[model samples]
Target: MFHLKKINKEKSDYYFMSGFTWLMGYLMIKCEQQKYRMMKIQKLYLFNLLCCLSTCTGLRGLISLEHKVYILEPMEEGNTHRLYRGEHLKLTQGTCGHGHNISYPTQMTNTTGHKRDAQSSTKHVELIIVADNREYQKQGKDVEKVKQRLAEIANYVDKFYRSLNIRVALVGLEVWSDGDKCSITQDPFTSLHEFLDWRKLKLLPQRPHDNAQLISGVYFQGTTIGMAPIMSMCTAEQSGGIVMDHSDNPLGAAVTLAHELGHNFGMNHDTPERGCGCRATVDRGGCIMTPSTGYPFPTVFSTCSKKDLAASLEKGVGMCLFNMPEVKVLYGGQKCGNGYVEEGEQCDCGDVEECLNPCCNASTCTLKQEAVCAHGQCCEDCQLKPAGTPCRESSNSCDLPEFCTGADPHCPANVYLHDGNACQGVDGHCYNGICQTHEQQCITLWGQGAKPAPGICFERVNSAGDPYGNCGKDAKGSFAKCEARDAKCGKMQCQGGANRPVIGTNAVSIETNIPLQEGGRILCRGTHVYLGDDMPDPGLVLTGTKCGENMMCINRQCQNISVLGVHDCSAKCSGHGVCNNNMNCHCESLWAPPFCDKAGFGGSMDSGPMRPTDSSGVTVGILVAFLCLLGVGIIVCFKRKTLLSLFFSNKNSTIEKLRKTLRIFFFCKSKKIKPILRPFIFFDIETMIKHDDN
Candidate 1:
């Protein structure tokens, strides 16, 4: 949809119309059953229109979700510190680490059944970036652009999984080797076999479900830095395993594949401690897999890390629980172990609780019935404390009388007036059960303590007075608002500014509202040399990021590029060159210029054009110039006569005769109608009828 804004009578009034001629064409391919697809397109258009609308309306609040991946040469994709977002991407783009995420505006419509299916089957792999691309190269595809290609794959993958009810996984295929031996062209079997070996797969760890499907795969086919800029191949779903060149660092390929493979199994980040390499803590940031930035820290697992891993694995790849050898060993092939079936161990319900346990998680306990009283005293007395009384013994409040076991009273064992078995101080907090000081909170968008700023949380909003970041709600991730008190690398400062490009040097790829290709190279302060369609009529070179979805392409340019005229002549002509949406254009009459640029010429010569002829053949065909001049007296009498003063010339007399014949015939009837009558003087109509030869 394209929109026009008018400051109507002092207030703004905006009008929206379909800007894309192609949209009309697309709509014609109508499949009523495919409402989801239509809705998505509509949403995308509306979203685009809204951006313009907001700018015109002066509305401040707007939200945008951008999916971007960086195809890093030496490193693996998306860096682990970038934790799995846990939000399913609607689309993906490009490959390797560098690709845009795909979210088609078209897939917004969902029938109830379709929605259910999507929910049941497609769970989000927060860590695995999914980008989309939608083009088939006329020339061979440029597979070297790992990021570009991956984005395309993401789109397809997202659409495929949207309506599926089965659990889907992204598979990463990077090669690896063993024991001080590393050659590239990473082998999946050699590298990945160790991480998720059949042995590990067979140990049933958690709840089991049977919905599973492969969403995507990643492999390496391109360059790896120093060799060439074209360095990788990535699937939109981040599942494409790595296929490294022998010269490439095989370990990097392996890890990359491991990252994507983990996504398939519902792993958000590679390391579970929220950060990587042993600085294990709930809040300490590490690898993206662990919710932290610092990885390569030495130990991969810690007491706190193991527990988190057990839980995540159990939840995401619950099907793996049945992959345990015990389940398989006893029951044909079940991964989960225990006792109760025809196997060595049964009661899987119990072992499942333990296998999934790690330092981060509390261990599950078995249930048993016991006497209410002991030794004639209240058996409950053996339990120590009563259930209702609060225990002030510990700050955790776990020692509350209700849970008091005289044998052991620890922090969390008691209760408090708050959640997380703890409370926040004047400037402290246990956000989502994690503790942080007031200074930390102040640095956060939410900040800490009482109103840091007024009508806001921490500071005044940028440009627009919108409530900045998180006041009571969450603020935008990956960006923070700025503060005056901050300096380079100081507190409360926006990281890289809110508008920096996500990958590399914060330089954004341009999106044009110009007459050009969607994904082509465009340079600032210069016009793109079009390969084919380049019209010379000068117009502003579009210099921006992406044309709005609602805009249409006209003569290789965007349709909204028009004068402030009342109607969109070009836009209307976009469908049919003659008529515009406002209903005006003379297509048949238009000649040299654009058909819609001006009104058509009209005349009252109702079905009329008099034929004219020359009689030069009879007057001057055989005569010399002098002779022809001598015949000027006759020429003057007859405008139809012709004479060539320089050279004798002739005109066909037959044409002249034909013209005269037509002229007389048409002139008689046209000037005035004359009724035709028979020569009745001889006989009246009645007499003639009576006298007719019978």
Candidate 2:
């Protein structure tokens, strides 16, 4: 029930890799019943799903990333934005770089950014302000609260940023614990793992860092409690990002800053490749800036996040900055660098392709697409075409003017590069210029009859999965640009046009048992978000939707999910001990060290004095002797089996003789069998009957 858009050869090639690997594995495993007995059918299914999700989403593990983002939260809130009781509000609309309408508080704005201008445009900043009151009840900072809030914020930011064309990132060192247990690490990579407690990867740079300088892996996060209008308007104005919070968690405030600042760099929760399947992957896990209330535990993205980020670089988007040439790079193909490869060659090989000529040399480079040669690689006349402009706009370009100015521009939005006849994303994926309408990736995920992500590129399974909505002012999917640019979504969502899906991790749909009076408490980790009165009956739609305004979080509000990530352990032990959250159970003193480590033998152990190792030397000596005897018997049997079997030709007869021999060897071992082997013993039946009677 899905129509796959014709992905470019390169994209298709990447997508099919796991399939190839799985197929090969399946074939080889089928032949290995004797060689091995692993990877059962159920395991294979999970493995297949994992592979598909990873490939479709382009998810990366810790090592896959090229750029890392760190969200910082200030411990002190004096300098941050402020808000009052009436001024504070729940999320009202969707925010940038996050997802799933399922995200709590769709939209929020506390303060705006520096204004939008050529410079700000280059800076990739879009401003939206939302006042957060999740922590209004708590008089002070709660480490647990901060942890939860950061997860929500990260999830929100993941989807919002992707949609807004802003990049999303993670926490470097997540500070969580009671004041006495505050975590401070000396390790450079903020590994939340180690000696019984280790760390996770695809990490964002985190450590004590300076605020004035914006380093690649470092960012500032904190809280504020001063101005309301300023915070509300900040989301609109991009002067200096601020979250109005008279009494919000410092973590929330800090993450808000991180989320907003990320926008300043034109990052979005979405990757350059806006496929439904890909976005689903981002939302499946929490983003760095998701709201804290939803997921309050720690979790990190797999390394595939690197690929999503790469797509942005190809599309002229970066953390805190926009690269102009990248726009050209998107058009020219994700390869050929960011500018003119052969002055905008007709084609740039997939980043992996290496070509040698005066035009390009890629022997050393293995990751990026191959570059086009400046000389013989391209036609002299065709090379004159500008990478961004449609063929008609460039001299000697075969593309006609209609292609650029027609009802449909040559390269639609979300598609950065046009390879003369078609447009493609930086992921080297293509959208059919015309005819097909569905987003192949989404349909494959939701199947039929399910509502597609809000503002679906097209309707039905055939609908366009176009990452960027229709380009015209009145396009059906117009929400894409407006949301990305931080503009009002014209009467679409608030009025209930099937509320847009704000992308975020761990969306849970609520089904209340009874209709509440007007107000009810929103429970968050034993904390109440509301006072249980005044507000009308409302149930937040978090499941399956992206975090919208929820992205405007301020800290490392984390949550753990098996779907996203699970804890790691070495040898997973402590004899019969189960490992959970990276912690091993030593059971008790009787179980030495890692509780799963058994008394080096394969048996469930219990603490008792009937132990086998009670008398080490004596027990060892006896065991050795017993084993030696057993080994000698086995060797002797192995040597005699064939010779002994030669005389007992019949299969059943041989088995009987072996059994009798075994019994005699043990019971009547003192009597040798040499005398009984003579042929005269043929009086068989009558002799056996007489012997039995006697």
Candidate 3:
């Protein structure tokens, strides 16, 4: 019976071994199949990636080739083209009507009462280009061709603005193939008004962009090819321009578009009197802001344009330009050289030739090994800056500061006071991120000591519907009289400044003496600037100027600031914060965001935390985890005789292994290695288990 039992046990052991072997073989086969399948998927993925990259490269090359061919094509012979002189040219000659002289203050401080150093930062303009029906037809009724032309024009403008530390990113393109969205006419003034109104009412609501420009095929009256409001960038009322496609070559239209865009950026004509330095001579196109544009379209901006941009930025003229545009909305297909970091790209420092960043691999648009970041003010030494590090300081009263998050390389988008919020250090309220007051406008037109005149001046002067005294021009290009309530929203009347309007030589002073019932006469000084028929009169009151205690101007009407509902937005802030342009509560440093009632790091949801994360807790957690693991290993060794014996047999070896493992763990912790690499330490534990099993 004993012999039979022994034989049965042996057979059972043999069957168990066979079953184990079969299971092992099956697992190996399955693993091999999985490995083969994974390899095939990897190969297919690589092939698809290569094809996609090739397609993008081919499309970009085709576009470039088309652009080169079009540029090389000569202008139509015997066209007898009239001299393309823009009306803004009169600015240099002082021959046009009164022009607003935008003088830079001696002190380089912004309206927010802070020093401005905008040169150290870059600004981006999210631009949308629209083609009128006539322009679409001119391009052979090809929507794609019209889009290409407009894109090329935007590219040229972007190139011109690069020197000013500004980027013009084309976000959208609209081809008015069916018809013009707004009125287009030979009268440049009426056309500009209509286009701006349409842009504010229609385009702005549908597509959010920093600015829009209309490229038209219709010829403007006289020598005007383009017109834009000066120093009106990012404003809802006048942050747009109209450009006439006067030349078959897109470069000519690009130059005119750049000039009009410059006007929006607060740049004036590069007249000889400004003593502006131009690297490109007249034969090669003197400067982009030159009043007259002819052959060899100007590609470079003059020193004056750069200065104007800086001054405008300091004064918060282009407040919205401080934020980067959404790369996904960019018009052109993704390219490595476009400077925007798109999906699948770790970093982008511009084209390969222009890339000078040590942390970035420009060709592949990826960060170099060990680099966490390569761009933005919040990234330094290839690492993210600590939270609460100030990235963008408030530029003006309405502007808000942005801080680093310690998790992201880029700074947050800009924020500002809610519209209708009370302006800081000024009597007026915020509108479109600007604090416009009558006194401020007076100072801009006249020199120092300029102040808004008494009520009588505005009441009497704006009543007449003439060029010298009017609310603004009507749709028919005729002056419109201002009602009694809308008087302050019309032509600005001032007192005590330069003897004549300091704006320009063409500006004529209109003095009115209103005799009071008591006796003495009060002198009212008003300016009439003949800025040509196309441009809006700078002598008129600005759109956001305060008309009364709680009133502001809107479309030549005095409206209550409460229409913006700023009070309701502020009430949610719990008095510990202020309402930002996004309508979120920007909490104080000690309070949390979304609402300010919570006690935590400050800043709005749009911005980052106002304080750095605590590191002591992380250190403590790591130490505790290490202790727990050590305790578990000790307990396992005590509970298992095999493991305990193994440790006793090779004490020196075991100690040495433990030392090495600990060293690796400490090193990884010190370097802040990612969690994926932490599993490597467990291999040491596995080796010990294998030794015990053996």
Candidate 4:
């Protein structure tokens, strides 16, 4: 009941060969079904054998010609961006008091994903800072001083966030003053929470897709600063907003804002109870999350706090701070081939030419000397050669045999013998790889001994390798070795040596060399350090009020000094177009330049999907043909037994044999192959069988 299955034309490039085998098998089966069993069976077996041979030959041809290589296409614009969780991280800020609104310097701007800061990480955080006009007017603070203070605080916070690689931008700024007695006294902290819920103000758009965060700031000049809730309502909370007392100490205010934002990002207070506490004092320096502000300002966060922050950001709890559109950070993982030698990379030869290391393989990013060469010869080929293999030192050098001794055999760089090596060229001694006199060897090792000492010459030694003979004793004496542990120590690294002090522990003493001091001891626990009784207030050490006119204060460091003049269009574009350094307006397609004052129906035209070139088309066609041939072979195998039986049946007369022969010939000819005389030979056999039966 078996029947020939349909072949896939696209993959049937060997259809003619498969058809020929099927025909031969059919004829053999027919021969086996005759009354003369012995003779017919022998002929059938012979015919099947021939078919198998032909099939194997045809299969070999198909396999040899069917392979193809796929070329990678260039990446399209915005395609990689789509791989991110979202397009942008939006941070909405609400400020209290109006006279002087805190504005961030252009250096703190976050229009794109990457942040340029000391942290050396990349990412973006959209910022929208607004002032609550009612609270500001009610407080009635000096506008100029308040504005200056707010700017300082804003600038500080911007730097702090940037250190975490979260670019900060003040995208929205407004004054809200139309309410009744919405006084600063009405608990600005809790009131700010309500302000976030006030949908009518609509100062910022509520786009959950943007992964936004809301932070609010309050300032009261004469009012006493007291305990307040700097709440960050995260996944575990119903709402989120930070309320801070921003009167004096801009540095303190910035720290407070960061602390509250940590809460929203799902970080708990890092106090003694939570496993990391300050050794200097029980109340302070455990982290930015310390319940009480023992010091006016703390510049560092504890290890636990940083760990929690990293986790929060990784878990996507801190809205817009991590994994947002255009933001790249450690959480996103490192990408190879950026040309920079980053973590987890052994080598990065942007183009292949940069790789020149002897044992390194640039293309595969691995070592291949062991696999490619024998013990003594250089790795010039991917096959093992025996010891004493002939080699050349260089293109200009005379040929020499390789010295096969180490794990990887290589030719000696110098022609002369080394220590313990047999001398050559009528010399019985050697020193520093050169043939030497008996006195020279004694001078090199024993400093010109009265008599040349026996076996005194030893190989020169170094930290990385053992010497040929006893040379010296260990220098550092006995000391317990501490394993290297990863820890955040500002710009310092904890690499487990005498000078590399361990950080994030209960007690450690490190020598400090900051300006104004010759040298002093810094005793620290977690991120907080102890100040001596005679020492000045810690606030001065952590905060700085001065910076170059063109620079901004970042973590007490002056940075963001532009290499070139900046071109800003805040006065012209009105937010429609970005001004380039050349002072030219780069407007959106829908708006015209010159401040983007005019709107028009203009945008990009959509083109159809990309199509392959003619060469690619040809490649695809070849692949299709190969597939078709494979499909046909599979189909032929499926009905092989049945076709053989039908052809060998006694009822398959001469006329039926002729018909089958004609059909197979026609099929083969249609496939664009020269018709073989095998079908006619089969007809002749059929005729002979018929005559014998008569």
Candidate 5:
């Protein structure tokens, strides 16, 4: 009876287990099907949204959406999949004047003024981004959301600049939760000026960076969406720009910001006259520097932009971009394969697929075995270069060279001549690592054979406060007259060049005849470019121009260069060196720094030695000295016996002479002749002996 009951219980348990297994299997299958349906629904919703954007936004060539949209979701941890779609929007029609629309003459080659091999090297822009109060409010006053949006915009900008061999590293992000730090107005020019001033006086002192950008939610007065000073990158006063947050999507603002930043990099508008080559057609996104951006946002730079960047760099613009940024201060959290050498990382060459460094293991962001370094100009074959190795040469008259420290795997940061220092090969002063002169400016504007007009022309024509002759526009947007003392700092006047302003079709020549007191009249030619109200007048004399001896243009005034204390700084160089922008002495090739009084391999403390230590030469000198000493010792040893015999012979001749002299004296005494006779005889004998000795 017991055995029968046990068997029945076992059978019941087995049946229950089988039923439970079947139920669990059915539920799992149902869940998988539901997941698939959800994924399909999400994809459909995204497709419909894209279609609506394309139709309403007038985005053409978007039918091939698969090729246009890029998904970068799984790359970021905890971040949802983001779909970058639609063509970049047309934010502004303003053009940058940094290049001054100056067209190079066909006969004049090498317009860049210097070689630009440095363009091939990667440049990192340590960027700081700020969001205005309006932007903060537009994002529901959520600081985290604002920060996220700014980061995303920076990512897009980085993507855009990557092709140009430039990296936009976001070092800091700030949100003005309380209010705007500087005044923000509808006038784009005024807002830009105020923001730049604030950046120079306040933000720059607090946090150091290569450049800064302000994103605002307020719409500008006109069609202008962004503005920046052209070719002013890395400057303390104007290395920044302003962009309006015009689109709900961060990509739109990103494109606008990138356009303005390009202006700072000296890139001009890709106008039809330029005939700029662009890979992307107008139906696609076009190029980043297009004057009038439209439906599709431009994500690529044109050939003109690339050429402009190269020219600007060769002219010493963006001097601070060569050095790598401190990865510790990077805004984003640390992660492997981010292309930065962070804490605990031996080296980082980017992600596994993009990394091309043989010295690095991309999967772990670590250096390969026996590899000392994986990056930097000072690192070669995964090893640090010797101290005094030239890593960067001077690009222009005002630029200084950089060298390797030997101990570090990177070169020192770039330095240049101090402001107010006289420029080399140019009749101007160095300011912000550029030698700006009226002659150079005229040549750029009017092609070749252009010279600055006489002083009388500048004095007479610039006195009138009009569009044709003015210092610049005031805060209220009206032209301001030039004071007599500041006349040279006003609108530039030239005498000879091409028939018309060679800059562009939009530029017109303004001629004025000044009757000299001596009775002859001089003609002054000036330029006016229709660059809109957003840009500063390029016709004005650029700052750092030599308005007078020891005087330079500053804020529309002819100020003494003494104010920069360049003389004081140069005095410390001990007449053997020049002062760099950091106010330190850059020594001569045979002198040491900090004073340049001692002899050593030359360079400033900030930059490594200019020449190598010459270890091989030192070794050769030591060997030569040792060989010379050995030769002298051998000669002395071989001649020892001859020297000894000569000494003994001389001693014997002296002894014989003494004995003969004694015998003569005794014979003279014995003869008893006159004492005078004896004295005469002794004297004769003494003369004979002296003659023999001589």
Candidate 6:
């Protein structure tokens, strides 16, 4: 009296329901063979209700439904990595020039420079700053001014790098000049390399270590403004240097210096031409990689820049920054005296008497094998013993004399009475038998009065001569639970939806147990229960709906049409500044207006241009007149001797006055004359003309 009918559904749904009926019957017969008792078939409405809870609220919903239980399984795919930390940075700055002459001293003002808070940085980066400005020293440039300039430059650089865990310190300043002249103007990059080569050979007695990054600046009367070390930042080459011009603007100089060093640190310009994904232009203050640094400077590094820098570091670029004098070994450790081999030792065992092997040398924590001290397995007890050696089983079983024969001689193998032959032991079971046990047959149940099992429909006799058929626990052929023992039968799981089949032992579902959505139907493929419209595209959707935030619904689920936030104000706040949670751009300094546009903004608004006032104008004019009179008096006092000498020589003849002018020209023509005195001679003639005119 089991009646099967097709309900109103789609073509695929109808086929799925038909297959489900067959699958359910097969599972019930398979489970009965395992001696599982027939249980009352649960109503289809109960399983359908469980599906509704599982879909909307996840595992918690399934928990509320006492009949179904599920565990939250972690998906392996979508994991995010944390930022890099604890990298080391070593810094150096060397100022060089032509050997004999002093170059212009670059000014480093500590008071006027930017200083970053490196101590509060999360990344544990160690910084060391060293400098050598010998060329400036030889020419009598002001040492104090040079030191000030270095401090200022360091401050500015530290500010720029503080967020990156880079701290800068001024460690050493020394003069390193040789030869008569060393001008770097002709070819600054080439000149820097030559200077670096010379500097390496002349490292200070206390500075011979190769662990720190060498950053140097060369001062010279070169036509070139500045130059950085070639291949220093892009490759594994560690040492990098810059050529600096003292005459340049301090801000511009610092910026340019930072730019060159950035190159050495594996950063490129923020344009597609430089391999950046985004194009950096005047309008877009996206990054600092562009050639011209304008009014509103870039405040942050671009995503491309950060990614490339990380990639370069991961590729071993700039590792020379970690090479330091304090490091004792390539693989870092402490010496032997600190109660461990970590200080600077290969090994460190406690005492000589405690060493198990006689050859063990306690003083060095090594084995003296044939007069050679060995670190790895040096003692006899540490070495592997050979086979057939007489040994005790273990400390607990020392009384049993055992002969070692296996690969690990410390553990002896079991000896049989006969080799390659089976023998019956005293207990009568075949000992050391190579044969495997016989496979068990499937358990079959007899039909009551040949009416067949409660819900089973006999299909055919299986290959094992068992009457296998579509089976279930109930008379109506609806199963409370079903299980299939065959490998082809695999496993059954309960699935509830509009048109889906529920398969399992009726007791519990194993392997995977995902409940179906409210209106969603399920399809069984092997042991998997696929739910919803996603069953058609198993590859498209992983678990939930396959639609994105910016998608359109074609049928029931979403499909991608266009993406959001690509060119909107959200993309880095339109490149003006960092975007906050409220979706507004908080602009950086030198930037104004809403979008952070660079055209209208120049400098800070608070420090605008000043206009002349009536009172200030009168005061400025009076001060200028007073200064002019004082300058004339001082000129007459200092040039009296020259004026008197000229007056006596010109007093005799009319031709003497003309000869006096020619005499001045002859004085300038002489190379022996110092250039410093030329300005005074011109000033004296101008004063005499003014006096005669008056």
Best by lDDT: 5
Note each model's CA RMSD in angstroms: 34.9, 30.6, 20.6, 37.4, 15.1, 43.9
Worst 10-residue lDDT window for candidate 3 reads 21-30
- Report the lDDT tens digits of candidate 5 across residue range 1-694: 0010111331221111111111110000011112210010012222212211110111111112422632222213332223334443323443332333534332322223534366788899999999999999999998876876787678778867988999999999999999999999887888899999999999999999999999999888767778898878999989999998887667678778999899889888887888999977887767888876556656778998988887787767788898889888887656566677899998888755467999999768888999999888899999999888888877777888888989888778889899998884547899888888888888877878999998888888888989998888777778889999999999999989999988677799999888878898889999998877777777789888889999999988899999999999999999999999999999998999889999988899998987746768978879866755554454345334433443466755644654454454454445442232245645654665566677
lDDT of 6 by residue, 1-694 (tens): 1122323332111112222221110000101122221111112423212111111011101110222222221122332111111011111222222111101111111111222121222221122223344434533565443433443344344445544544332333333333212324344545555444444444423453321222234543333334443224312123445535332223334444555455555554454434554333345333544444432223335555555455434322342232112323211123221122333344444333333434446556554565332222111344544433433211110011223332331222211111111111111111111100000000000111111111111111111111111121123323212222211111211122212112211111112222345654333211122221101111111111112233322222223322212224335434554332123343444454345565322111211111223446868879866755554444445444555566666533423453454354444345233333356765666666566557
| lDDT string, candidate 3, 1-694, tens digits | 0010111331121111111111110000011112210000011211101100111101110011111111222123331112222221222111111133444443333265554467778889999999999999899998866876787677767776887888999999999999998999877778888899999999999999999999999887667778888888998889988888887656677778888888898888888777899977776558777778664446678888888878777777887877788988887656564688898889888755467999999768999999999999899999999888888877778878899988888889888888887775658878877788888788877778999999988999899988878899776678999999999999999998888777766678988888989999998888887666767787888777679988989889899978888889999999999999898999998899999999977899987777636657867989977865664454345434433454576765665656554555565556564323335445656676567567
Instruction: Give candidate 2 regions above 4 Å deviation.
Output: 1-258, 261-285, 293-359, 363-382, 386-694
Candidate 4 local lDDT, 79-146, one digit each (tens):
11111111111212222221111110112111123221212223344443334553346346434333
> TM-score for each prediction?
0.20, 0.20, 0.75, 0.30, 0.79, 0.26
TM-score of candidate 6 versus the correct structure, residues matched by position: 0.26
lDDT accuracy of residue 536 in candidate 2: 10
Any idea what lDDT model 6 has? 0.30
Superposition error at 238 for model 4 (Å): 5.6
**Weakest lDDT window of 10 consecutive positions for candidate 6:** 435-444
Q: At residue 462, what lDDT does model 4 achieve?
A: 13
Clashes of each: 105, 152, 5, 20, 5, 27
Q: Arrange candidates, best lDDT first.
A: 5, 3, 4, 6, 2, 1
In the range 450-509, model 2's lDDT, one tens digit per residue, is: 222333211111121122211112223221222332211111111111122222232222
- Score candidate 2 by lDDT: 0.25
TM-score of 5: 0.79
Judged by lDDT relative to the true structure, which candidate is superior, 2 or 6? 6
Clash number for candidate 3: 5
lDDT: worst 10-residue window of model 4: 57-66
